[model samples]
Target chain A: MVMDTKQPFEKLVELHGATVLRVCRAVVGPGEADDVWQETFLSALRAYPELPADANHEAWLVTIAHRRSLDSVRAAGRRAMPVGEMPDGRSPLGNPGPDGDGVWDQVARLPDKQRRVIAYRYLADLPFADIAGILGGTPAAARRSAADGLKKLRTLMAETPPQGGTP
Target chain B: MTSTDRTSRTGPVDLAFAPHLTAIEPGALHRLRSALAETATREGVLDIAYRIVDSPVGQLLLAATDRGLVRVAYEREDHDAVLQQLAERLSPRILEAPARLGSAAAQLDEYFAGRRRGFDVPLDLSLSAGFRRTVIQHLEGIPFGVTESYTEVARAVGNPKAVRAVGTACATNPLPVVVPCHRVLRSDGSLGGYIGGLEAKSALLALEAAP
Candidate 1:
């Protein structure tokens, strides 16, 4: 018997788009987040019905965005600087006021592996198992990496001198 | 409030990263919906059927034409809004028929089941042209379980310096999933920006990378 397996796409968007966008922003920075977000959904639309019902769909889309975001960043590097380097003047972890530049700076300073893992597991809020797959490691390894990265971040935070504190 | 006061309250780290953490505004959703609806309602166009396809992450509102699929939206109450937008942007002929999208819908079903890898469907990409089309066309070549960087895609398309433009094209991709835009990544192997949201993007990448 043929099942009437028609799933509504609107519901999926409402439920998942916000979470997906959050993760994308964290992974790639806001400068190029929206582009990746749009591309992710477009890819989903074409492949939705084929997606395994039992499979973790959220993980699937996040993986796609991650790869795409990475591609864009690499592409930006190959292209002529898009009008000054990525505003490196800002402090890596200082408050940039309402603009969020400070947080982004800190995130940028993170080693590539630590940054990707942290962004995926913490900022993007993905599970370690899923993060592992994205990073091509075991779930346990991914979790350990994330933990180590977070620990280092906390250390970095502690070591940072207060703005007005004596050197 | 003064910058100093703001910094003191949220703390320097919080203040610096707060903007990046801020969610997409509800107004943007409203505007996107409105824009899509307007574009779907333009005059003199043929039927622009739309439907919502439920997936693992969220609902995907897909709009199509007799020629092929046109637009796909994520998370909006009024799917018709995008259809209307399409109508306004191009020509009005939007309708609603699941049967018309039989081939696409079928392929999608197979893909979700993990029974399929790529799609084989005629597309209607009147919304994009020139460099955008070139970028998307090359994007299709990215095999499942494999990925390429935006710069790589640009070079493949014969314009290495257009990597940024390639990214812009990806951002503006009118037909996303079918074109496999999610397979692109950074040279450093980090996730990138996505319009449908990064979670979904990551989800797609994860699915591809899964054993």
Candidate 2:
């Protein structure tokens, strides 16, 4: 019965790991999502013991994920020296839009705050308060960002023809 | 699925694109687990990496902390139960991934194969404390192929009259075969009860006694 003790950390990973992955991917694009996700959980595991038992587990993990995403972006910015010709801004999602994972491409085109609020609110299903807690704003601002982000995403989706379609 | 967990406010947002969002990140979890282990070992925070090896006696459970080998268990001790005990005693942040146990396992392999007499690997004896810890430490000094009585072990630990307490310590020896608790026998030159059962005690002694 001792083994049946609080394994909340492993359970935390099992529950929200995928959503955290998507949140990071949405924020920083796929090329860096893996590192950021790993960092987020590693930090979570390190601090897990001291965490309050009554805390919101999802918000806590996403908060960690949010910080790690910024760290990866900063690190990549420093290491991003000039290389060969840059790819077209069109391929920002780092994959072919025709693959029908174009949601990522559209999500990639969104402004940073809108992208994160959408990922946290819709994709990860965090409430506006948790999203605001993670991204730092009032809950009303979180809700506004979600609405604005969704409105822009709809416009983009409507006007942009599918990449492989006859035009 | 929607009735209980994962319930969320869809609000007024269109969600036709939710599938791509919820689609699992391929191989991301595996990468994260590996990263966790690597960073934990590197950072020395709640690291609980372990490995298992078949011995001349039985399959042994080998676990290491950030410092060194922390535990060794016999097959009869139930390796799963042993791991859980470790999880309880230490942290549940354990993985059976065998990351930092290479040297310890190889030394144990050599000891079993009769190539080495004394262990050269570091030990994490945090599991033992106070009198029991001191008794076990004295047991480690008894040498390979040599035997000591529990009274002598008690005396070696500067507690000559604590014989029964010494037996209690040996009975609860967390590292067992690796720490050589089996080398402590009855003062009348007889095998006493071993945490690993008497036969394992005899096997270890016999294995060491072979010339």
Candidate 3:
């Protein structure tokens, strides 16, 4: 019956892990998302003691995730290996309509800034300002990138209209 | 509009991946935590490792210091509060990584399933000291399916007059089941106060006595 407050970082993983993993997968693709996810938490654990106690934890995690995902991309670049194959419309894991258009592939193919903005804003539900903070730009710039990314995604989906429910 | 709210007007740019976004393999987080614990241990910074395990009574909060399994608590103990106690009495650098408690968890599993008679996990007794520490240590020798009177436990530890203190020790045993504190009974052979409630004490005794 002893009362206490838990400051363990474990709660953070239970809370924001899905969002962070989603951002990683959306930004870097599933092939590398798990590694980026690992790196993000590892970095968070190392620096957790130094983080401001009142800091917005979700934003802090996204910030770490953004930086870690970029590190993974940069490391991949140094190796110059071809990225993994995009999900074909027929992925067993993907909910495909009559014509599965590989929506994940389309998201991956967007311009880098647009992909980052969309993932930061939508997947992680971070504010444009926080996304700006992580990706280094003004809030307006992040918003514009998200809008542009959505415009392109809407156009692409118009042609095929990603049918069927979630996989 | 808030920057996050404005994104909603952008026609669900994340819609295409919403399903995937909502789901992450539980294993992914587990693996990440395992790796994190490993790196922190290798770097000599991991102070406490813990995981939740279901027992005959209910979900238990099993925590370990770098030294050994330090705390095992029942759900009624308020896992969050127990974690907080662990953070305070132990260290703030605590994490929930089941891999670190695999052996202890397995031993508990076997105990609940009625296949194991004893726990093999190393224990960190830093949480208890003085008479409480002595009483808790004596509890480990009580043996499975056997009950010892609190007065007897106090006597075993050279403090026969500290019967009430022995009862208090059994009530506050941080590593209750693993330390076999439930095996300690009142002088009248009745269940005494259990941090997890008398019902839990009865349940544990019943589980151990099961054929």
Candidate 4:
């Protein structure tokens, strides 16, 4: 399986690297997400020989990414820790402020599944079907999970009073 | 604190973070490509060099390393910014040498000339990881002229709910032309935001869509 000639795979990296990273970040947190992403691609490279020539490569890669993210979460024992700094080098947990309106902090407080789903669906903007495939559920189920998570977030946002309110 | 004082405090807090969200600049784009080439050449690892080419809409900067073409940039962005970004995000040593990027530049020239449809160049995407890499990989599948919805891209990547994050990736695309970030659009068929500006996006789309 001399698959070293697959130039399209390189193109695939240029095109979808950001998308993959976003999903990994959402699921595994930003710090540990890169390791998972690298592993996913490394696996993809190893399995490239076996992939059907005409198969949807993007779909295949995503499936691998989903599994890797889940594995990363499990391996970390769901510690609810923040990933490392963002690409801009900003801290993931966010710098605390006087009124405590740091968006990252609010995001961190979310339940693990909900937080991952929100980052995946909203922040990453992946389709429900793809998310479901990664999460090991039907598309509808994925959508429901995302919706439920969003509802919880809305509630959190609502409950937090605006700083320096009249009341 | 008084109610008015509280309101005033919150306002500045929000504003303080706003500056960090500034858009990419053109000068930074030029500097980045130059720096990347220089560093790569200095290390003797850059087999290819990059040159800044002018297109109808904006400047196009390309990078070629020993492995292949490593990056592309839009005219409106700062080359230094892009280079610094790559250095900070990926590595510290990027060099400048047009010969290293000659092959990529040739292909890109053909693309601009309407003689070529797709790119065949070596890439070094070591700058990003995780969801960002996923998004960039997906962008590669978009054909030269055809476009896909952000949602479709998300679905393709196996996380159908990540549309917003997908958009962010597009906005944050480090290698614009090479990755073809402009090809991704809104699900509703509208042109989406581009770090290079809407006009430049429109121009690229038009070039691809042309017969």
Candidate 5:
């Protein structure tokens, strides 16, 4: 494709911005998702001119988003907590808001590999082959991880009944 | 990649995750977009910034570079095609950042309302060059409500035999109303060709002519 024939970067953001944000929130938690989202696109903008016109824009953006989420998670680990006392409850990766349905909180409880598999497959709608590439595993293994994650979620949801439901 | 039985079992997960997928807050997205635009500008990656504004003629597309306002296209020109041409001609790093073109839009608004005579916004005349550029530069000197013949403009630009060339420049003027292309007329005192079409030419002339 001709160099000048490329669509503006704004169109890319408009098309995939929300999906990338969802991926970021699911991967790094909502608290740091915005920061990661901004970083992902800023990096993308820096490289957008060189991206091939035939490239899969959504997958390419998801890949960038995945890397940014990892960076956010690592940075969050290195930051010193200001709280004097630590809570006795499990230190889930994300904050399960007071009013939220707590499905996300259960997702936060999932093992890292399973959490990432679910996020990439379900949230980003990426194929297992793509997920395997992102997570460094075989397509079958990625599929197994997704199944395991869903199975565990179902068990967890069953054990903890939906809050504020009908009597 | 899976069988029907497996899909049925795993299908519930998709539904459960659907709500979280769309958890975007409009306010947060707006803030993120604004912040991203600012950072792009600061980093000098923003090549062309554009926005649309309503006018008596129609909605006008205003585009600017870091130097100054570059292009002002009327609705009849097909804004999308114009933008595509801009992307091909300029860099592809374009954004719909209204703030960068705010001053230009305001000045145009003032001019359209008949409160302002001359445009004070800095212009990027890169789209026009050579004779066309010289013709537009001279057109700016014709004053707010005055008219000039294409023949007279040709002579003014030191090319007495270039009357047709002067008309071509006015017809291809990238910044129409701002460059005052509507002020140029045929030798018979009739309106000549305008890039924004005849109705817009009439509208602009009438706006300038009104008391």
Candidate 6:
């Protein structure tokens, strides 16, 4: 039945705001996620009116966020900051507790492709097919990237060990 | 695994790791919403701002342009559909920025509580035009607690033959309750059609009739 009603831009924000924030934080770091989020949504709001009624808003939002994150990444690369140091002191995941640093540090250490695959797969809850549509390559390749990312992440976490644990 | 649809599945990542990635800072969403509203306004793209208000009648959808209060919708009117309609007719750059409609919401609260008799907020009136606009403008002059027949309004608008047209105007009034469309009744003193349903119309009339 082709329902052509376009919801208010606010509805889109309410529905996907958190997921997009997580995607932004994962693709970029937590320190820069908010800015990327703002840019992504501003762009979305500007183009929302013209979007086809039945288009998948979630996928569309993630695509915009992915592009914006890439832009910021390129911008940061041009600046040529020292490796292994965050621009800010905040934990990678914005986790404040002592135990959080190890988990997010490993995530931040991941190669860009793995980091994004894990993010889009777990955080955004997008299918591999959709993730491939955003990131390029086939659905199988996207799945493989996510699997490799998870395996690598688990290994890193195992090596790090939790801070307050039984000796 | 290729045969299985992956859309319905979750990632193999352990549940414990999920929280680390999804943890949102306190006030993050609040800050985002405020920032979006501000940016949209500053960019001159917030074409229509809307908010919801609770009243003796029901939840009312109050929408305004920079010009002033543009739409006052009843719950029965389907607020979502109303917003979509507004998006189509007006610009699609609408946001839930309450500040623009703050005055209108406050006025409605006062009116429903019987503390205020008439609304003083600026109105866009662009939604209604020609004969409908003329009829709606005449409806504003309708004093509180006083009811006028559609026939009377038709003659007052200088078109005695447009009685049915007057009813049509009142039926399509974008801003009900505030516009006093409930004040217009059938010539036989029977309740006529209301965009907000007959019960809402009766509730509005009863609210006004109160001492």
Model 4 over residues B107-211: C-alpha lDDT tens digits? 878888899888888777765579988999889778888899999989999999999999999998867877889999998889989988999899889998887
The DockQ-derived docking category for candidate 5 is: acceptable
True contacts kept of 6: 0.48
What order do candidates take by TM-score, descending? 5, 6, 3, 2, 1, 4
Worst 10 residues of 6 chain B by lDDT: B1-10
Model 6: per-residue lDDT, tens digit, B86-189? 98778677889887777888888888888999999999999998999999999999999999999999999999999999999999999999899999999999
Off by over 4 Å in 5: A1-4, A80-92, A161-167, B1-18
Would candidate 2 be rated incorrect, acceptable, medium or high by CAPRI criteria?
Answer: acceptable
Task: Provide the TM-score for each candidate, comma-separated.
Answer: 0.45, 0.69, 0.77, 0.44, 0.86, 0.84
Per-residue lDDT tens digits of candidate 6, residues A40-66? 888988888789988899889999999
lDDT of 3 by residue, A47-115 (tens): 776666567888999888888877777677556654464322222222221234366655655677787
Model 6, residue B199: C-alpha shift (Å)? 4.0
Off by over 4 Å in 6: A1-3, A74-101, A137-140, A161-167, B1-9, B25-27
Which candidate tops lDDT? 6
Name the better of 1 and 6 by TM-score.
6
Tens-digit per-residue lDDT, A108-137, candidate 5? 777777877887887777889999988897
As for TM-score, the candidate ahead, 3 or 6, is 6
Fnat of candidate 1 is 0.09
Displacement of residue B100 (Cα, Å) in model 4 is 0.6
* Greater-DockQ candidate between 2 and 5: 5
Q: Quick one: best TM-score, which candidate?
A: 5
What is the lDDT, from 0 to 100, of the residue A90 in candidate 6?
26
Question: What is the C-alpha local distance difference test score of each model?
Answer: 0.63, 0.75, 0.76, 0.61, 0.80, 0.82
Pairs that clash in candidate 5: none
Error of 1 at B102 (Å): 24
- Relative to the true structure, candidate 4 reaches a TM of 0.44
The DockQ scores of all candidates, in the order shown, are 0.05, 0.28, 0.28, 0.01, 0.37, 0.36
